[model samples]
Target: MRIWVVLAASALGLAGASRVAAQRALGKLLFFEPALSVNGKRSCASCHRPEKAFTDHRGTPRALRFAGNLRRNSPTILNAAGQTSFFHDGRASSLDAVIEAVLTSPDEFGSSYAQAAQRLGSSAEYRQLFRRAFAAPVAANTINAALVAYLRAQTATASPYDRARAGGPALPATPAAGAALFAGAGGCAGCHGGPQFRDGQRHEVAAGQWVKTPTLRNVAVTMPYRADGGAATLAAVLTDGYHRPLPPRPLTAPEVEQLTAFLEALTDTTSADHRAPAALPRMRDLPGRAVGGQY
Candidate 1:
């Protein structure tokens, strides 16, 4: 009788937890909303455009409106959820931390939590959504939770490589050789390995680069190779190993060919799924607290 009661209670707790999670969709909706930008125009999509493999469309080292040398090239959102930390500096630990940090970044959203929050709370739409998603509505913590859920939702659909190895086309000779070279001499797979192609580990590659080592998942579409735009093409990035103002790697010309082939294979090559998102959220600012809900 005691065991049965305990099991029933456990199931009830899980059911409540799921309901709370469902209410969290508000945060994800806000992520792509341009209203979050200080200019009332630049959304997360401004830098991490979904259509372009979730990166800056222009592929500029520094964004058009940003200050000189935008910290690092805006990274791809491809498989970012799998990343251990956010940014080339590995500064943020989770999606919420990064979202809040960027929302107040003078270079990015440049808005305060109180100001943004009030903007959100004032809206009937935001209020109702928050109430539905939260135990109540318009709380700072609740807002943050919503945004975190939104970011975590940004997932990449399976690519050709996913299909190929899962029982379709065999890796062509060049890419096969490249894969071996990557796991072997070229050491391409040293940092980029496994299905998603990134260990989510930062390496001291000690090359003229410093980044959290982005994934090769969609290398074909996410270009302007290198965080600082040191390499213009994948081939240059692979063989020359993306440069720094200082120096580059020791990769040779033949190595570039093999590596490029491997990277090219990382592209989906046939998926048209990068369409606009469904149900664009209504974004108004959030209210209460200062520093734009600094997390």
Candidate 2:
């Protein structure tokens, strides 16, 4: 009886792992499925390219059906799993709300959750994947849940900076100097604090307008900084763009270089799966976009 009990427990654990894998796979397909968009031309991966540290590398991405452009930069989804708020404006209270806004926004997927559910349900492969993962039919809630699961799984792995802090090799001199300025005179830590490097609160940059503090985990790669993507470079982000006034003692050119080095040292790509799947779900009239998106 003891042996049987142990075997049953092991079997259950294996089954749970299998289910998680299935769900993750399904979520990946959904993430890259352009057919979910009304025009069938874009996917979530379109704006959040994996190789570019999960950013589109665009200042502001074009909107659905080419209907103008989004107002803010496409922030990296890396290490975004546990952020308190979503988007530059912090309009969405939760990730679920963020997904829903994207689904229905005319500048985004340009489709409703009901429409997406119906479209996905028509694909037998998607239906099977959904059932296997959720033990339910293809629907709005399951689709959202799968995406949330996948997004939440994208946590950050240690970087050079993190390793150094863990008693590994120290950061090189330039980055080490930058780290000092960041935590000290530069006052970057005032807002970009915590393990994720954000305060999870909005602050007034100039006057009445407020913007959410963004995570600095991969800030090196997700360039064209600020909520509006106005700052073209790291130096520019420090000197101009959207930010509160710097310390009364301005950062000198050398200090700027050091700070940039420190910011770059924060980049770590190992935590998330960046590769695009070879194909997406089999849906009629919906061909796969490029690994990310064409735009």
Candidate 3:
């Protein structure tokens, strides 16, 4: 009788794990599916290219969507699951809400939840996948939940800096020096504190422009810095892009280089390479235009 009970419990656990795996697979498929868009050309992966550290660097600051250019730079979705707020302005409260906004926004997918469901439902493959993932009919909520599940799995915290911090191996001298400065005289820890390297608070870096503090987990690759993508380089971000009055003491060129080295040490190449989705062809040939906005 005990043996039977144990077998039953093991079967249930396996079923649950299988269900979760199915959901994550479905979510990844949907995230890369352009069928959710009006033109059936643009997918979430289009702008958030996996090769580019989940950010688009082809355009100026903001990525060009199906409708028009985004108002701000496309922030990396890596480590996004830890963020409490979404978007530069913290507009959407949750990932589900953000997905809904993107689907309905004219400048984005340009489709309502119903429209997206109908479009995806037309595909028998998608229907089967959705059924396996949610055990329910293909709907907006299920779709959003699946996408969020996949996104939540997108983490990149195994960088050299992370290893060194964990006492695995000592970081090289340059990066070690830079890391010290980051926590000490640089005063970067005042804002970019914690394991994620962000205070998770919004502050007005400039007049009337309130922006959420971004995580510097992979700052080395997530370029076109700042909320507006105004600062083209890390150096630029450390200089003129920050809130005026500076962080007490100013950073010298050498200090900036050292900081850059420390930031580079934070790159998680394994995550970047492993998480990239298959390449998708461009939907439209419209040229991207530079837009003016504040981060």
Candidate 4:
């Protein structure tokens, strides 16, 4: 009887796991589904390309939405789940809210939730996936939740620094020195201190503008730093942006190289690397649709 009970519990656990897997799969499809946009040419993945650490690496100052350019740099969605607030200004309180804003924004998808649902609902493949994942009809809430689940699943915590932190391997001397500086005189630790390396709070810096402190987890790949993408490199950001706001403890060229080396150690050579799912469905185009590119 005890064996039977254990088997039953295991079966139930497997079933729950299967459902979660289904939801994530559906969410991945939706994330790459450009049909959700008004012009059927833009999707979440369009701007947040999986290859570029989930950031657009076209060298534009801001992200290019279907409607227009965003006012700020395209922050990487890698390790974004650890963040409390969404966007550069910390405007969206939750990931769902961020999705809603992007969906309806003129510079983004430029489609209402109802329109997105209607479009996606037309696809029999999408409907079946939704039913299997949610056991319900397609709707905005489920769509948002699915995407959030997928994004949250995209955590990048397995860097060399992480391994070193867990005592698996020691970082090299240069990075080790930089790590000490980060926690000590550099004052970077004040905001980018904890695990995930973000304080989850907004701060006023650089001309009185309020910006959220971003995660330094994969800072190596998320270049063109700051909210405006004004700084071209990590060295520039460290010397100019980060240095200007604090007291006169300056970093030398060698120190900057060491700091950069430490930042590189934070890059996750594993899950943080982006690759489009092979099973993603092709999008149907809308004729005569004008896509916006500026925010």
Candidate 5:
């Protein structure tokens, strides 16, 4: 029902690196502390709802405070720690850099390092945590670093698919079927290869498709799929294709069911404060790799 992510214990760097306990301690709190955002109301938790696999459950491309609509759909935070890079563009490299970009991005919080420093850097609890985590005073850089560390600490869920991979006992037949279909004929295992299920690359629809390919860990939440966010459910994106490749690539009814069953089986209800219904919502591809990588 619940599984925390495990880091390989490889050190990231000197101070405020990787998933070390000291950094994670502060990072966990920073993950929810809205003070870091331009608006105190929009914490990382705002979009990446802890209960909903760390993505906004709303179906459309949500707008930030005063900012215009963002380009890509909000990717999930679950199992993101294992990813090579973040976002549809694969722009940011290190987690800390990702936080810094989000902090200043016009469509996101829209705050600069100075603004974050002025706000969160002054808090007593945050200050103390900074001292403990990095042995340095709280600042915008460390603050962002701590937040990124916390995010990297949020790992993927382990389901029957995982257990089966590990030679575990009996699991649901449909999910098992779903898993096989996903990795085989469904072409899911193509981009969604590896234990974490992503090649960390981006691809648009082949001929006439819309949206980017999101991870399968928590497919139940995050409706209104697509890079443009035109569709509402996972079903819509799968059937409609969101416009990227040109026209929609409709899935056969049976294929749709199998894929849905497979993805739904990957859901984890424990991290969520409020659970997304155990219903399959919808589904993309794209290409790139870059700096300040996530996961």
Candidate 6:
């Protein structure tokens, strides 16, 4: 009887694991699905390309149906799970709210939840996946939950700096020296603190404008820097002298190099799941290279 009970518990644990995996897989397909958009050409991956550190490599992603272009740069969604607020200006209080805004924004997905549901629900493949993942019909809540799961799974925290912090191994020479400067002279830890390297609060960068401090997990690839993408390079971000609570003093040339090395050492995207599904559920016009959409 005890053996049977142990086996039952093991089976339940396996079932739970299977459900989590199914949810992440379903979310990946939905993430790459363009049919949810009014134009049927854009998806979350369009702006957050996996190979590009989950950023579109644009200062600001171009707005389709809306007037001109998006105001802020396309911040990387990698390591973005626990941010206190979403978006550059901290407009959305939750990740689900961010998804809702983007889905309805005239410039973005440019559609409504009802339309998106209708399109996705038409796909038998999507329906099956949703059922397996959530044991429920595809709808706003389930879709959002799957998306949240996938987005939260994109964390990349195995960097050399993190390893050093964990007492596993020390960082390389240059990065080690730079780490000292980061906390001391650089004063970066004042805002970019904690394990995620962010304080999750908006800070005044310009006279009247304040933007949330973004994580430095993959800052090497998610340039041009700043909320507006004004700084073209990491070096520029250090020398621009635009941010408030500036470093104790101007960083010298060697110090700048040291800080840059330290920042680069924070990158650890090797573990992120960058695979795209073989095909979307009911996507009609799958492009030759449509994994991340046209953009």
- For model 6, residues 1-295, the per-residue Cα lDDT tens digits are 1332343234336568787788778888878888767877788988888888888888888786545788889999888888779998898888788888998998888899888887778778888887777766777877787787688888899887888889988888888888898887788898888888899999888789989999988898788888887788888988886732388678888888888999999888787987777777653343333554555
What range of 10 consecutive residues in model 3 has the weakest lDDT sum?
A: 286-295
Give candidate 4's TM-score. 0.87
The clash numbers for all candidates, in the given order, read 19, 0, 0, 10, 37, 0
Across 191-244, the per-residue lDDT of candidate 2 in tens digits comes to 999899999999887678789999999899898888888788888888773432
lDDT, candidate 4, equals 0.74
**What is the C-alpha lDDT profile of model 4 across 73-192, one tens digit per residue?**
878888888566899899988887888898887777778889988877776777887777767677887788678768878888889988998988999999999898788877888888
Of 1 and 2, the candidate ranking higher by lDDT = 2
TM-score of candidate 6 versus the correct structure, residues matched by position:
0.90
- Highest lDDT scorer: 2
**Candidate 4: where are CA atoms >4 Å away?**
1-14, 58-68, 245-248, 282-295
Across 9-105, the per-residue lDDT of candidate 3 in tens digits comes to: 3433656878667777777777777767766667787767777888877433332243346777888888888677898889878887788888887
For candidate 6, what is the lDDT? 0.80
Residue 12, candidate 4: alpha-carbon lDDT: 37
The lDDT values for all models are: 0.62, 0.81, 0.73, 0.74, 0.58, 0.80
For candidate 4, the per-residue lDDT at 132 reads 73
Worst 10 residues of 1 by lDDT: 286-295
TM-score sort, best first: 2, 6, 4, 3, 1, 5
lDDT per residue, candidate 1, 134-248, as tens digits? 5466755666666655555556645655667788787888877777778886666657777777777766545554567677878878878765656668876654423322123
What is the lDDT, from 0 to 100, of the residue 149 in candidate 5? 64
For each candidate, give its TM-score against the true structure.
0.76, 0.91, 0.85, 0.87, 0.75, 0.90
Candidate 5 per-residue lDDT over residues 124-242, each given as its tens digit: 65566666666566666567556656666666556656666678765577667767777666666777777676777767564444223567676666555655556676656556633
